[model samples]
Target chain A: MTEEHDHSGNPPQPDEDRLAATEFEILERALRELLIEKGVFTADDIRIAVEAMDRKDPANGSKVVAHAWVDDAYRARLLDDSKAAIEELGIDVGPAPNLVVLENTATLQHVVVCTLCSCYPRTLLGMPPSWYKSREYRGRVVVEPRAVLREFGTELADDVEIKVVDSTADMRYLVLPARPDGTDGLSEAELADLVTRDSLIGVTQPNAPSGG
Target chain B: MSDQEVAPAFTAGQHVQVKTGDPPGHIRTPTFLRGKSGVIEQLHGVYRNPEDLAFGGQGFPKMPLYLVRFSQTEVWDNYDGSPKDSVLADIYQHWLEPGAE
Candidate 1:
């Protein structure tokens, strides 16, 4: 990487060293004006929704794992009807009767993408991160899933099966990560520590040793 | 959204090739799946056109969207499945036609 390597051929540096986060009020005011002009979702509604989501606390994908451990029926239900099974935990997602869940273990892995459109389970998870919505990720995930996961910091063994589940009608899937090996009798909070958002997305395993 | 309508006779299991490079700006349908074959796995009730939504669409039961499934091999002739994988996508009925292949 060098100055001559700059694509635009202007030395590879910011034009000025004044990059700064804009005031939150400016953003809020702009959004408020847009919402008013749109006349559908008002800024007040947006404020309330954001506040409600913040007050709702973090997700409980880990609790679902704990239930799956102690209760056979729940595990079966999670596999059979993931939406209803998860809705029991109060996570309501979808356009109804069209939700699905896929469990990811060492042998069987599942990753999700919306090939046609960005149909996501917003009710369960909050707004999707920017990376998931990028064109580079959407184009490559299906064609080269393992490579995409590797970019996300997950490397798969040669024998692991990578199944990239797409969001579609009558079915949408979320990854139920395999329970950790040494966590057989851990408390729910302790177990929650092992379930990262990466695991939920099926990029990494629960027991993989992180750090060199 | 306006109360206008567009209709197509796209049924389940039939291949509908998405017209590639037709849309400008950001689009949900990927360029790879364009001109590809997929199975029509589901028919959703009603959805307003996303194009309209991007420009402030509001309140409608107008357009129809279908949930289609495509295999990795279908999209790409040689997928190792190191990682046996398949992809599903929600396509507007118009993006499809009767398969000749």
Candidate 2:
């Protein structure tokens, strides 16, 4: 008879109130307020920064991948100096950590993980997914990469050597997944559409063109 | 040591082993990698030491970092993957010592 039972044949809804903030969250909020009070940065500045970070996604990485796929010279340049090559696409990575692009070949497959912390290519691929930050992933990916990859529906052949690169220091890694076959006729934009965030992370390959 | 004064002791393709110790404080080295032998894949340039930077100290005497490669079987007791599989990590120069091939 009350609000709980007034759902008109629908099941009971769970409470939707927000949970309490953690210690780190409290500290961050306090620090932000203190900084704002001291005129270090205005609230608008913080909002703009957060918005810019949120606006970034896998598309930025996909553009780079697509460009490299069509241009052999660009691919070579990306492998040699990722920062400068990426900048040519007008994607500014800023004064970020050193970006290393790992090329996946027929015999070698590369996967990236941050065993110490979630040091990711945020400027290129945006914030990492939740699983990339989980303790399970951080611990297992290095030791049991094949099994971990299998869980993500990525099955590598026994002949293929798996290379797990742990982002333990200042350098960040981006996996250059092998371009799927049978799509040589596709345009760069269409190829970009096939690139997923998981592919960039080396957990999965880019989805192949449908019916191609 | 100043950045200019520090020279990379190890070079590409050279075999080396990570120094084994549980030194206290903010260390960038992972515990599992300690004592494991690997080859210096490449010199990844010099950077300010994160250990000192973490504690607000100037990360002076920037250290040369290298990409070290280790076979999966060598790193783990019973690595389930293929013997050819390997793990690579960006390790600082200070944590490495020359090792047998």
Candidate 3:
């Protein structure tokens, strides 16, 4: 064999280029550092509680809608203490006591938007969508809600009361849109499809069943 | 609930706006909510002012703040709001007054 194993005299070892974290990671690190420095929160505390953020499932919102569709009393209770109502079904609305849930019936249309930032009811609906965080959605939703709803494929009539809520302030909200007509006996999971995040936030009315 | 307080700058049901030098983005105090009026509900104290902290400062607990409520119509004239409609927002002591004209 030829002297292929020879390394001359000095050889350059691999530099081991590790992948860099994204902006999210950097910000997370910075915030974590600051939280520790300021003693506002500890890194371990965040690590332990971060599971709550992940435990959120969109199905939670659907469950509420489905139950409301079936039982009227349950619906009233939900409208009252939404946190308790959510918990009754094993879905948490979180300890953010300031959380408020608003429902949209056929006579009214309620749209939720965080004008200040992307503060949604993360406890029940999981994370927010990309469009929700966009400047266009934030500015337009608060200022010109009707137009924004139209862009989201929902056109409100002159009669339908349009309540554009600024989830920006202390009160955060989730819209319990009225269930589509004739979905009478659909199972919870089956009804969940009709309750998209958009529909729950009043951007889109619930999809009506094929036959009804 | 319990914090130092400065003299009241504006009476209840007065209009005011935010005048902080914080960065241009979705701040806690919204531009639209600012300068709008309904009524002053309570005087919430200030432990840490956002403007002082956002730019990296110890922010020696400035003069506390107050919570103000505003009707959608008052904030936006074209707002087709109902009689029983209103939203309350937290504005610092400096961000309030009688008028913003």
Candidate 4:
């Protein structure tokens, strides 16, 4: 949705027409060809990397959270060294930004937003949702966190403290939402199904599984 | 920015103020945080300078990044949240200076 365009009353181009190779696309093709010619990287390598990126999704983060909830040892490791902890589960965040996990407790809540740009834990959560990248969210979350959270239907008690984290540097954050009650008997995979992308982002808490 | 791994000048629990300036080109420091004071929550380790990396540089001299915490009331004059509410920002070393205790 972020684009540069002239506001001179020109009708918006159709999707098909716009997809038909614009100047930037042509330039990109030329540049890729040049890079391949210079032996910087191979076309096959690019293809594999793109495919791998596409495979990343919030389910990866859910698995980590689920394990943390059931295993106290893993929970401590996750908070102390998140990158290495995730690697133990075969999730590689190579070339992605460093990651940190923030724990949410009964008296504390954690929320994350990148006010400068939509910098997220892409390797864990995949592509960020449109709402996370909107100007409206970036501009207001830091100044009015409670109101913004209310809009997300997350009303917290006044006694609970809210902590809004602005991820602006070389690191990305994940909120380790408190484990929902009655989930102690569930297996790791079953618990993962209860976690959602919103909970990891701290906008909402994970829903309790049915028949728990 | 050199590629040297310099040690961080500040430490956790130290009060610091975000340096005020409008440097152009590929900056991560948000405008609203400039000149604001906060306490360092943790040292998040030395990493590549995003400002330099954005302009195609090697992102060297890897500066220390800190998690700084500011109270809701300190950041906004009319904050509607509970007094326990606080905001944390990940800021690079160069953007911060010592603050009054």
Query: Each predicted model: what fraction of the native A–B Cα contacts (within 8 Å) does it retain?
Result: 0.56, 0.94, 0.14, 0.94
The list of candidate 3 runs beyond 4 A from truth reads: A1-52, A185-189, B1-27, B38-101
**Runs in model 4 with CA error above 4 Å?**
A1-13, A16-29, A37-44, B1-3
| Residue B13's lDDT in candidate 1 | 69
lDDT of 4 by residue, A34-152 (tens): 99999999999899988998889999999999999989999999999999999999987777788999999888999999999999999888889999999999888888887888899
The best candidate in terms of lDDT: 2
RMSD to the true structure for each prediction, in A, is 7.2, 2.6, 9.1, 5.0
Query: Quick one: ranking by TM-score, best first?
Result: 2, 4, 1, 3
Choose 1 or 2, whichever is better by lDDT: 2
Docking band of candidate 2:
high
Q: Candidate 1: how many backbone clashes?
A: 4
Question: lDDT tens digits, residues A125-165, model 3?
Answer: 88888899999898777666767777877877766766666
Report the Cα lDDT for residue B51, model 4.
90
Instruction: Return the top candidate by DockQ.
Output: 2
Deviation in Å, model 4, residue A90 alpha carbon? 1.9
Q: Can you list the residue pairs that collide in candidate 4?
A: B2-B61
Which numbered prediction scores highest in TM-score against the true structure?
Answer: 2
**DockQ of each candidate relative to the true complex:** 0.37, 0.90, 0.19, 0.81
Which should have the higher DockQ, number 2 or number 3?
2
